[model samples]
Target chain A: MSIIIRGARLIDPGQQLDQVTDLHIKNGNIEAIGDLTGLNAASEINAKGMILSPSFVDILTYLRDLNQIQKGTIVSETQAAASAGFTQLCASPDTQPCSDAGSVISMVNNKVVSAGFCDLLPVAALTKELKGTQLSNMEALARAGCIGFSNASYDISDNNILLRCYEYAATFGLKVFVQAQDQQLGDGHMHAGATATRMGLDGIPVIAETLAISRHLLLMQHTGVSGHFNQLTSAKGVNLIRQAKAQGMNITADVGVAHLCFTDTAIDGYRSQYHVQPPLREETDRKALLAGIKDGTIDAICSAHQPHESAAKCAPFAATATGMAIYDMLIPLIQGLVDAGDLTWALAIQALSYNSAAIAVGKTPKLSVGEEANLTLIDTSHYWTLNSSSQLSHGTNQALANQNLKARVKLTVKRGLVSYQM
Target chain B: MHNLAELQLTKNGELRHFLTPEGLDRLMLERILDTADSFVVVGNQEVKKVPLLRGRTVVNLFFENSTRTRSTFELAAKRLSADVLTLDIKTSATSKGESLLDTLQNLRAMHSDMFVVRHGDSGAAHFIAEQVTPDVAIINAGDGRHAHPTQAMLDMLTIRRHKGKFEPLSVAIVGDILHSRVARDQIHALKTLGCTDIRLVGPNTLMPQGIDSMGATTHNNMESGIDGADVVIMLRLQTERMASAFLPSAGEYFRLYGLTTERLAQAKPDAIVMHPGPINRGIEIESAVADGPQSMILNQVGYGIALRMAVMSMAMSGQMQQRQAQALVSSSLKGEAQP
Candidate 1:
């Protein structure tokens, strides 16, 4: 199948290309870019007053489809990601059986291939069953199409075991994803601050993130391993990652999108939807995270999309599940940031699409000729409200439901095929 | 987000549920105190029962272990002439792996008029009130470290009976303020009752992060906290605090921050000492000071029944009124629909 997108402002930060132009795609590849006025294909899109850019990539997400279909499935979550303009997703290994074996990776790959909507890069568990005890078969997992290795939120308390895991990954030239959190100091449900005090809930201090990041940085340096930090929550954590990169440590970091939009105070009245892990921190931490993104200390922005069934969030605040089903409203939230002048269009596109794609796939996506057609068209002036009817994910536990959003994803193209359309 | 304080009241500004005292105004708090004052006389009578909740069914649902709180709530419900059913959820279907929502749904199906919930999770009562059973009245006996509204109101009763009013009083709450639902509710009640000089006395580790922002002063030393105070409230020191490293030892806590006779003397000459008891004698308070002439610990317990009865009756009446109003509106709409 072939298509021609006409008169859309194409933006590709990786190629520094931003102009209103026509593009031609033939057989799942961009055939021509500049003023393809005579090009004809089987399909045509009149993309006037729209933004055509490389489709977004989410570096961290959870698709618990294998055993927890009640929460979400591979097909359901990928469909939602496509609606939100993401064509690639790196699924975390915090699944029911824990993606620590080759079979689990194969199962996910088979499901993604059958779905045919987006690419799923599985991050295999570093430890067996993610119990932080024995190491998994890293070589076998890589052969099964694992993009990286991580223990997810579970910590390896034994320093010796952690050092060995890093050393083993370094030996194979593998990238290890670290979610820095000292479990002992991270028992609280929300960030340690005045809001937690007023609510009378336990607080997880900033030391939990800083201390764990500090240890992991030192260990990664010692083992000469390529490390990537996931969901940095505190200002001090950003400083640590910044210093490590300044010293030429082979490290990269990203922050969850929810953390950039909210602080601990959003948990007022004990709203269970705001109950996330690596809890929403204070305002200073939120501002610092934005600064880190602007200065390039933070590499990408992830959806951190965890889908839960309604029953999971139907309990008390502390007893309720610890995530929001964010994929259904991810782009609108980012659009909100851009409209408020808190983020620029270039940086937003870079963080959401180019940077995330490079980190997850080890190569940046482009909108130039001869490249595979992976694109998203966004109507920047479109005003829409997100509610249960508008939400596409199976998980209806959205925290931003019924909220007004400035932009909408009008269409998504993956491999030169229309994957999603408004 | 549903505010517990607002959820506890009807649109007519009457008590519908007694969940928390945080958003309650001075007039509403004074009304609760006044209502409890009338119930105090019923406890002294030969009958010791009232017909305020005669046809209502009150269910005491304790998801956590409790003896004193459960007994007081049960007695309060009984004295109000309401049929009471006590569910020891720790050994019931909850322990059999049933979810809290499932258990609540089963209980709700029983058509119980009110739920007296004491859970180990914060905001459990609020969840039930907002999500599960909006029509049923909910009394938060205790929920995690969030709130114990009835306990705070009873303490307020004790203070008013001894000191005559709340405006001229200085109150000091000492011990484990961070983990005490009673302390949090007490701070809100005290501030709303117009007590400006409220002091939270405990070690920095034991004090919550922003107690001062709740309109109370923080004091690590007991003497300074209770200095010239009219009422001194001591919270129970759970032995688990030592195991969790929140304190060095019980003996050390007693030496530094415990309410000894000397520390008690720092308050006013006629100051009353109170404890939400099952108190450790030497850990949080000395035996002499606890049983001293100025001690009102037992009176607080006696007043607890009256305070709970007042809250239960008020909430039941408010729920009835709200239902009646909703019925009226529906009937009027039906009338308009007819030809």
Candidate 2:
């Protein structure tokens, strides 16, 4: 298959390239770039006045496939990922019949391969059944096509066992994704503050993240493990990770887009859509997370796309399942970050594309010669409302529903295939 | 209108569900007090019954056990001539593991026109009000540390009947305001009724954070808080508060902050004392102060019935009006279809 995208503003953050140019693809690879006016192809996309960049890489997502297919499936949700301009989505291992063993990893990998919409890189559970009792067969899971190992927000009560798990993961060269949280202290459904107190809901304090992050950082230094802290929601957590990096610790961290956009005050009306794990914190924490993103202390910003059916979020705010369906709003939210001046387009692309891909896949998908054509064309200045009617995910719990977004995905191409088009 | 207060009203701002006092205005609150005033005369009469809610069915859905509050609400509904169904929900289908929604649905199927709810969870009453069948009135009896509007209104009535208007009153709410929904509702009601010099008297651990932001001055010392206050409201310290380590012991709490004769002397000479009853005597108040000449504590219980009668009748009236409006709209649509 051969195709050409013409007159698009190409941005390759990994290569530090941002310019309007024409690119040609053939046989699932970038054939040529610059002045492709004379080129003729079977399929030509008039990408005039569009920002064509490498497709995004989401470091955390819960497709909720397998036995928990009632929430979402690989087929339905991966397409939602495609529509969101994400060509590579690293799914969390928190599914039913979790991706702990090689068989489950293989099942997820095979399903992703068959779906063929986008790459669904499986993150195997760091512990067996994510119960934190014993370590899973990490070697076999890696061999079965798991990209990384994560406990997916499950707390390992035994720190000694957790350190051993880290040591073993380091030996196997598996990047460990730790969602730092003290489950015991994090009993509440929302951020601990005057807001939670006034709302009469239980509260999760900032120490829940900072204390856990501090412990993990210390363990990372001791065990010599490559730890990537997923969903750091507190300012203190960011400061701790920053300090760890300054001290030459092999660690990285990412914050969720919802954390970047909303705060605990968003749940003032008991709006359950904003009820996410590692709950949206206060304004100081939010400002710090954005500052971390801007200064490169935070390695990347991910969607942390947790999709849930309407019923899952229909209860009271505290009782409702935590997560927002953010797969189809990833690019738009990144654009919001850019428009707010907290991040430049370069930094946004680096976090959403290059940095995330590097942590998950060990390589960034850059648009260059002899590279696979995984690209997204976006209308970066368009405005649209993100209501239920406009959403493509099977999940209906959206924190930004009825919000006006200033950017949208126009087309997403994966391996030279037109995976999505608007 | 705050959350619960806003939820208690209809689109036209009429009282639909009297769930919280935080949203009711001075006029609406005065109307409730006035309505309760008329009921006081009825209570004093030979037959304490009215035909205001003659054929209406009022269901008391108490998820938590409450004998005193339940009886008063039952009496109020009975006085309004509404057929009352008092369900001991803790041991009913809810105890059998039926969800509150499912139980309410089953009860709604019984054709009850109103629900007077008392639950252990904050916002449980609001949840019921939001989920119940349309045109069904919901009166929050007492929810967990959130709001007990009827109790707050009765306190408002008790204060008004004793001391007159709230505009010039300096009220001090003492005790575990952190765990007392009555205190929360009273604070909002006091503020709405133009009571500006409101003071919350409790230790820092016993006070809810940001209570000062609600326009109430907070004080740790009891004497300073009650000094020059015209009304002193004592809140019952929940035993759970002690277990939660908010206080060391009931005895220790009584030693520091308990209302006694000496402490009551710190307030104005004309100041009256109030408590939503079933008080923990010696823990929250001394027996002498509770039984003193200025003690309107028992009067609060009497006003509680009148206040409940006011809320039940008002919510039923709002629901009836809403139903009539809906019927008119549907009939108008049918007429249009005929044309």
Candidate 3:
């Protein structure tokens, strides 16, 4: 199928291109760019008031299914992702039955193919069963179609096991995604600060992330492997990653959209939905995360889209499951950062698409001739409310369930096919 | 704060539930203390039963073990002539795959009009209070380090009887404020009652952060905190504090922050020493200080029943009034106005 997006403001930060142009797509590839005044096409989108950018790539997302279908499923969540304008989402390995084997990776790949909404990249576990003990068959799993290797916050407690896993990953050329959290220091359900104290819930101090990040950064340096920090949630963590990147270490980091939006104060009411892993830090941390993204200290902005069933999140704050359905609200949240002027549209595009794609696939789609037509059409001026009724994911645990925001994904074209339209 | 105080009140600020000491003003605190004043005499009566909650069923839903707190609540309910059912929740249907809501619904069906909840989670009482039907009253016995309103109120009753007024009092609360729901509730209660010079004395690790923001001054040293204070509250140190990195040993804690004869002497000569008992003698308090002449610990226990009775009667009255109002609203909506 051939498609043409007319008069859209194209922002491809990777190629340093930002201009109002028409994009012509044919056979799932970018056939042409610039003026095609008299060109005929199978379908035409009058995207005059839209911002066309390279489709978003989310580095950390939970596509919970298999035994954990109560949380979410591939068909439900990927559809949610499509509407959120995400073209590629790397699913975390923290699902039930832990995605550590080639069989599980192939099962997810098959599901993604059948769902056919957005591209779902499976991340295999670093250790066997993610038990922090023996290593998994990384070479086999990587070849079985895993985008990367990650334990997904499962503590590799044995230092020697972690080093061995990284060393093995480095040799196999598999990207290792590290969730920096010291399990011992992360004793509490929410951030360790005034809010946790006032709520009388135990706290996970900022040291949980920073201390673990420092330890992992040392191991990453020692092992000389490509490491990506996933869902970092602290000011000190931002500074640590910044120093590492400045020191020219092969370390990249991504902050969750929730971390950029909310602080520990959001849990003041003991709202369980606000309870999250590496729980939301203070306002200073939120500011630092935004600043990190703006100054290129953080490489990407991930949805950190953890979907949980309603019953799973309806308990007391400390006892409830820690995560939220964020895929459907990802773009609007990033747009909030852009509208606040804390992040330029170019930087937002770079973090959402270019940087994330580089970490996930080593390549990103572009708005040039011969490039694939994986793109997101966004209406920055459009206002939408994230109400319960509008949700598509099986999990209804949205922390921002009724939040009103600007910016809506008008269309999501994945490989020249109109995957989602609103 | 926990918003439990707000949840406990009716739209017009009547006490519909008694969950936490926060959000209560000096007037409200005084009202509770005043009501408790009359009930204190009732506890001294040969026939202790009152008909205030007659024919009403009060269920003590203790999800966490506390025989002492439960007995006080049970005595208070019995004294108010309410039929009480004490359910040890750990052995109840909650362990038989029954969800909390299901158990609550079953209890409600059994005509349990009031629930006294004690649980291990911080907001467990609030969660139960929120789940109950409109006419059902809920009182928080204690919820994980969050609040113990009745205990705080009883301490207030003890304080007012001894010190006469809160404004002229300088109270020092000693020991582990971090893990004690009693301390948090007392802090809120004291602040609400206009007790300005509230001092929290403990090690930094044993103190809840930002607690001083609730209008109390924090002191790391025990002597400076207790000096010239009119009331001294020595909190019992839990053994778990030692297991955590909060304290080195029970002996070390006693040496640094324990209420001994010498340390008690730092307070005013007439200053009363109080402990929310099951006192850890030699850990949080010395036997001499705990059994000392200035010790109002026994008086605090005596007032506990009266304070709890006052809370139950007040909350039940509020619920009854609200239920009547709801009935009138529904009747009027049906065009059956009495007027």
Best by lDDT: 1
lDDT of 3 at B328: 88
State the fraction of real interface contacts model 3 keeps.
Answer: 0.38
Against the true two-chain complex, what DockQ does each candidate achieve?
0.53, 0.34, 0.46
Ranked by DockQ from best down, the candidates are 1, 3, 2
Q: Provide the DockQ value for model 3.
A: 0.46
- In model 3, the runs with Cα more than 4 Å from the true position are A35-40, B1-5, B91-98, B131-135, B336-339
lDDT tens per residue, model 2, B89-184: 673422322367678889889889999988776666776777545568889898766778899999999998988888899999998877788888
Q: What are the per-model C-alpha RMSD values against the true structure?
A: 1.8, 2.6, 2.3
lDDT of 1 by residue, B84-162 (tens): 9999887343232237778888988999999999988888888889888999999999988999999999999999999
After superposing candidate 2 on the true structure, give the runs of residues whose Cα lies further than 4 Å from its correct spot.
Answer: A340-342, A381-389, A400-406, B1-6, B91-98
Interface RMSD of 2: 3.6
Give the alpha carbon lDDT tens digit for every residue of B1-339 in model 3. Answer: 346557778877789988887777778889899999999999888998899999989999998899889999999999999999999877342232136666788888997889998988887777667743545898999988888989989999999998897988999999988898888889888888888899999999988767877778999999999999999999988898788779999999999998899988899999999998999889989899888899998999999999999999999988888888898889888886554
Q: What is the DockQ of candidate 2?
A: 0.34
Interface RMSD of each: 2.9, 3.6, 3.3
Ranking by TM-score: 1, 3, 2
Model 1 sits at a Cα RMSD from the real structure of 1.8
